[model samples]
Target: MANEVVVVMVPFLAQGHLNQLLHLSRLISTYNIPIHFISTATHNRQVRIRLHGWNPNNNLIQFHDLDDPIVTPHPIIPNTTSHPNFPTHLQPYFNSSLLLRTPVADVIRSVSQTARKVAVIHDSLMSYVVQDVCLIPNAETYIFRGLSVFYYFCSTNMNLGRELPFEPDKICQLPAPGESISPEFSEFIKLQYDHQKNHVGNVYDSSRIIEGKFVESLKRDQVNGKYHWAVGPFNPVEMDSDCLDRHICLQWLDKQPARSVLYVSFGTTTTFTSDQIAELALGLERSTQRFLWVLRDADKGDGSVGVKAAGPSHEKPLFDNYQTLHSTCRSVGLPEGVAGRGLVVREWAPQIDILGHLSTGGFVSHCGWNSCMEAMTAGVAVATWPIHTDQPYNAILLSNVLGVAVVMRDWEHRDELLTSVMVEKVVRKLMDTEVGEAVRKRAAELGGEWRKSMADGGVTHEDLNSLISYIHK
Candidate 1:
């Protein structure tokens, strides 16, 4: 076709990351470029099954399977199963040390020669691999922060020591672009502060703890002497490509007034206990605000002790409290007026489309970067309630600093359920007063700028063109 260019996306095997990268790849492929989505066999298989097939039009797009030796005892080929949970499909990928210099160098040597040129768009968390991957003469690597433009700037500025620029030895009240960041109840800031006290300098570096435990094992693959370029997502872009669903959520939006609907989702991965779900249901019921929610069958306990599937991993079993209450819910279920009082629950949702709807004024999000990006681009203010990982950090940035998102009840525990009163209070504030208006105005302004950035002569548009140019070089 138009000088085939291969764009390999290496996400952290989570739905949030996968969704964002897939969207980016679709954006590139729309320009008539070929995309050979190289992912672990298990994940690729899952994609095929979920989408019914990889190629819908049978045009310039295709999927290529890669072998990870460490996946199973078979190394190159292993049996993968179809599991309900998505992360289970990623288990095999966790064993391969793609970040190690030797393997990465080998992968480049193998793939680089196949295409006229190769461009690698990797997650920022996988920065260690950029060293070796970018070394190939024809290779150019990009670091996708996948968060907000401002958050990216903050992360880059947040250094480790005197040698670094803004390294805090403790939970210092660091300043944002325009305001002072207050730790308050942000578990992210609290944890970062705790981390600083326990381990000074390199506050962002959690290599030792996270490695082997998660994809951090990839860090072992870093090459010895290689230069890695770090580029932040400081430039915001509204992904308005035709690749997105156009009318999925518009009808729903047409029925609601501006700033009335509260969007609630805990992202693709974060699940909740049945009790937590009940609490959340009760909360939404109490709030009396119109809402759309994506609810998954997740428990507060570990269920991964036995099942071995090829798809996403299941959450831990429910806590003891849920074990007893689960039966109760099974019998009585949701309150009688809950559904009619303005709540629509679904297993899966047209998220990107929903956020962009004009009627969607506020989001109750887990603060995943992809969700944040979508909300920001759509001009929807957020109601932050982060669960784990970098979500807490994202939530803090959105609420305390950005002044766009409002925090509900800080991260809740199984024992500490978020009551209906807390939910109603947050929802009322998001819908009724000046604070809501201010947040809405800020989000709209930000979204408008982002939309402009992706136009023909805009900053993000130029950045994308430059990315293509780099690949051709």
Candidate 2:
């Protein structure tokens, strides 16, 4: 008998990247195709622990954990007057991740031998790990983008020889007019860009309904002869009963009126100074709107890499530094008066569950693409506070192009502390004003359109089918 075609997924170590590819894996598995998901042991465990939408154990996807890479310490420049705009703290993790290329290549080679064709789908940043797949006669590689297609188009417009429709400042990934990039982070970016040159096709965690104009624009502008698929809003439509019961926040949400509570979270990678956190709390208290906020210290080490042996020497020291900077953030207490109307979670909150709840009226988000998609799909308006990377671009998409969100703080002002008065103003506008009502209605309409894109004959459905058929071929 002929061996069946096999699909392999390789995601970057970050939670956002891992979660998207895992969701995609679940979607692809429904077609009866066996999938092998390869990653470091720690990241695989993290994804498994936090997995929702589907039960991982019952799925057709198999987890293959690779040995952990040895962690090396990057030199710390003490008393530096200027800090890099990028998250240079993650450099050690990035340096170690590069070592996985040999082992990842081995996994792909071994899996290709047993299958008629091996389709290796990797995160955009992880192309280096699977670069050798082209040498395998029966293996093909596809780059999975975790950001919105619109952000991709805008970021690459100049390189693609297309004139930008918006001002250069609008692309937040680029530095401000006078700002300078640190050499350390600049090298890191250059390395990632070099790794991206080897993919055969592109896979986006976005839908035509969300970015139809950009999708068509990219198709016409790029002459690379590579196929692009917009298969997204990968998050499941409804949370299972078990998932609902697991999070206590949902029970509190049950008591609130529909469209009354604001859900606040800044994603896993963002950290705030104590004064900023205090101002945020004061603002929420002053707004007097019912709210649910997820507050946690940013992950100090590599976001997801778990060292298998004893912790690296640099790990504890780096964590110590984070503690010093954010010590007040952890202990700064919210006012007693706000407790009656607000709920604050110090651990991971069931973000998707909370966003999908009927009580959730608006989201105060960092505008991460995954969070943006979840909010859009749930028909919730957003109060954008974009921090870095593609977040500013996503904020623009929601607040400007989509008209489903309002900007609380733009990336240009990320370093400045936000005062309580400003916070109260934004929160009240999102919750009590007629403008808020209009934004909510638009969000619901867009959400309906996004859902239709995944229905039986919708654009996303068709694109997903096309992807699977290509794998089978």
Q: Which candidate's TM-score is highest? A: 2
Give the Cα-based TM-score of candidate 2 against the true structure: 0.88
Candidate 1 lDDT tens digits, 326-375: 23122111345543335343334556667766667789887777677678
TM-score for each of the candidates: 0.65, 0.88
Error of 2 at 299 (Å): 2.0
251-348: candidate 2 lDDT, tens digit per residue: 77888999899999987666555556667877988899999877665444443422111123322322222212122222222455655568766656
CA lDDT, every model vs. true structure: 0.50, 0.77
The parts of candidate 2 lying over 4 Å away from their true place are: 1-3, 72-85, 159-162, 167-185, 192-198, 242-245, 301-334
For every candidate, C-alpha RMSD to the true structure in Å: 11.2, 5.5
In candidate 2, how many clashes are counted?
0
What's the distance in Å from true for residue 101, model 1?
Answer: 10
